[model samples]
Target: MADAPRSTPGREITTGERRRKAWANWSGAVRGIADSLLSPATTDELREIVLDDAARARGIGVVGSGHSYADLVAPAGRTLLDLRHHRGIDTVDPAAMTVTVRAGTTMRELNQELAAAGYALPNQSAIDEQTVAGVVATATHGSSPGLGTLSSHVVAARVLTADGRVRTVTRDDPELDGVRVHLGCLGVVLDLTFTVVPGHRLRKVVHRKPLPEVLADLGAFRDVHFGGFWWYPHTSQAIVWEASPTDEPPTPPPARPGALLSLLCNNSWTPRIAGAAHYAAAVAAGRGGARVLRRDDALLHHLPPPVQGTEYSVPFDRAADAIRALVGEVRRGGLRVSAPVDVRFTAADTGWLSPSRQSPTCHIGVTHPVSAHDPQGWIAPLRAADSVLWEFDGRPHWAKVHFRTGRELASRYPEWDRFQELRRTWDPDGVFLGAHLRRLFEH
Candidate 1:
């Protein structure tokens, strides 16, 4: 028999070693120049590293899979606690339909384990490379009027606070709502228990229609188990996706349309070519078809090309109007967006900092491929679209790029002060604080 890998505490790696392994995020947008990087294997070791007398004043930040496109994990001149090595399921309470996993576990890994145990997450984002803690911390969401964001599903969490104490928070705890989306400010999350359900399957259908037609009857779209759409501004076409529960046996997934066209469109050299092809395809497929697959298979989609963009959550009732306004602005400004505008719906949640808190929300995201020739071409349109969404009282996704300041964000969220108070209580010395967080809180 072989021994399983386990985390163990040891001395911090040398400064030279840290510099040699410089870190960059998934989009290569934010790069870090940290003083040192620590990979503590066990909870005790992590506590020791965080509580070290000399390291306390220098600050500490935790980095997961670095999947976030924002600057949440990049803290210059501070220690980065990389948790990638500390991963795996800890326990499963089948009777209660719950599972506890290390905070560093990725969604893809968790789904496989859950399937083996005849259980699964009720809802999940399209991409699954993000770690459990990272996803929950940022309030990551999928599209569904019935399902809430990922943090809303957390039942309990074991966290290592900034002051070197480990606290177990349950659903009954008052602080759980705030802790669910702590932004790594309150503490270092060790593990989390999420409520799950019996494994099931889903049937997904995709089709194209005029934007006005879909918006006229938005209720029909929201009534499904999961519904979202992509709007092509240039073509006035909408690619709609709706998923529903299915009792049929699982089948092999279908091949995605236009693999070569997608490749060409995503390539930096042929961006214009890609845009033309996409517009033509959307026009060609006036109406689409359906496919049935397992729950996990249906929820996960292929990773798209690197994109720099912003996402905002607006009131559900205002979704159609907001999109219409944004489209008008983009068209009026002559913005050349190569990608479709993504629109998703989510039910209200209880997390204090969740964008969808206590209100049914519609998320609108605009993206464009990174262009080397015209590096800043996407900025103008994105800002213009952002302005339109802002007028509709939209809230920015914590993990995505937005130009909101502390005052602006505080004004939007009623519980902002309470969350700040909790952050102070948990990390008075600001050990876990970073530049981006300071910008959002210190103001």
Candidate 2:
């Protein structure tokens, strides 16, 4: 018999990591909630507060909008560094196609401000709930043909090191690659400067079709525009496409007040009921698809709240096969996947640990609705099949759910050592080390 995979050192090295088992993340997956939550408005202030706190307990975590459900921000018995008060956009350079913003600013706020200036992010992830700093820190992305993840837009960033100092670095600098997606372990992301495209009008075209035809011609279709697909479980059909215009007017989709109300009901009364209703609607419609026109702000990022999900990025070449197999695994395992399987594309970028690392990739994200009726035991079977993702050289989204440990994380990220080394150099006292950071890197 094969031996069980050795637990990574980071998992058990620190007292905080041990206590993390009890913290609760955004998903309602409770773990060890922090004893104290600190909101710091300035980099200098944060640096001082972190160092002083480290004297007693070195455990610490930096959080943005708390969009990630994974333990990414769950630090046990440690000081939680909330950057919301640090929100600010410092500069915008139209000629350079760049803008500098505070770590605490949400994508929603940032886009709105940028639009007022006729500038916008070139690539953005699906949701506006994420913080600019957090998104870049975790390499969050959206579906777009030949586009890179949000971090790739970064040209420079200011970091608050453990020793109560601030360091501003740029893409041309040698340390840039390591910091692009530093995961808050290396240093607190104080501010980031990113390249932006001129704000423009965008038109969306969403429709449904057979999965086979969509997959077969995906590349050609991808070439014509920026978009992707969402496949429903228990069916071979898919919501085939949504494309954005390069030079269209800013026309946003119709706000779904009804859906919002339903979501509120789910969260308030029966979470499962809300998800079930949404799922049934999609399934009954065979596919509910729509196209809307919106300003680049609305088109680039605006997904209604999602419970939580696991997102995997596989090389474009293996995407279709991997997705089909994943679909089968869901059926074989009998997992109730209420959320549509999201598929998005991106061209490779130079960011060392970015999911799009030097290769075109497709992001396939799967989700199960939150339920009070199901136990952790019910998820056991599906969790067992997560390795299917690794089999295809898939990298799990840093912000989503996954069972992989630090060793697995190290192997997946080529710049893992660089990030660790930076953390060591900047935070020798482990001022920024916490349960989440330890799990993903310390080991």
State which candidate has the highest TM-score. 1
| RMSD to truth, every model | 5.0, 7.6
* lDDT by residue for model 2 (1-443), tens: 01323211111112454442334555565456564466655555576665664322536677676667677676566666777677868999878889999889988899889988888788667768778988987788866766788888889998877766788898669788878877777778888999988776665666667778877776674584577777755556676555665564444465554664335322322325534554554444433344445444434433534355777888888888888778677667545555567788888876777877887888888765455555353244335436677778888887777878889867877877876777789888776666666656656
Over 4 Å off, model 2: 1-24, 53-56, 246-252, 257-280, 283-292, 295-306, 375-378, 381-385
- TM-score, per-candidate, Cα-based: 0.92, 0.85
| TM-score computed on alpha carbons, candidate 1 | 0.92
Cα lDDT of model 1 by residue, 1-443, tens digit: 01322122434545554433366777666777766677777888889878775566667788878877678886576677888667989998988888999999999899999988888888888788999999999999987789889889999999999888999999889899998898988889999999998888889888888888888877775688987888876556788888888888776786664666465334433335545666776764435578787787787666777667788999899988998887777567455556777888899999999999988999998876656666665566567666778899899888877877889999999999999999999899888888898988999
lDDT of 1 at 129: 93
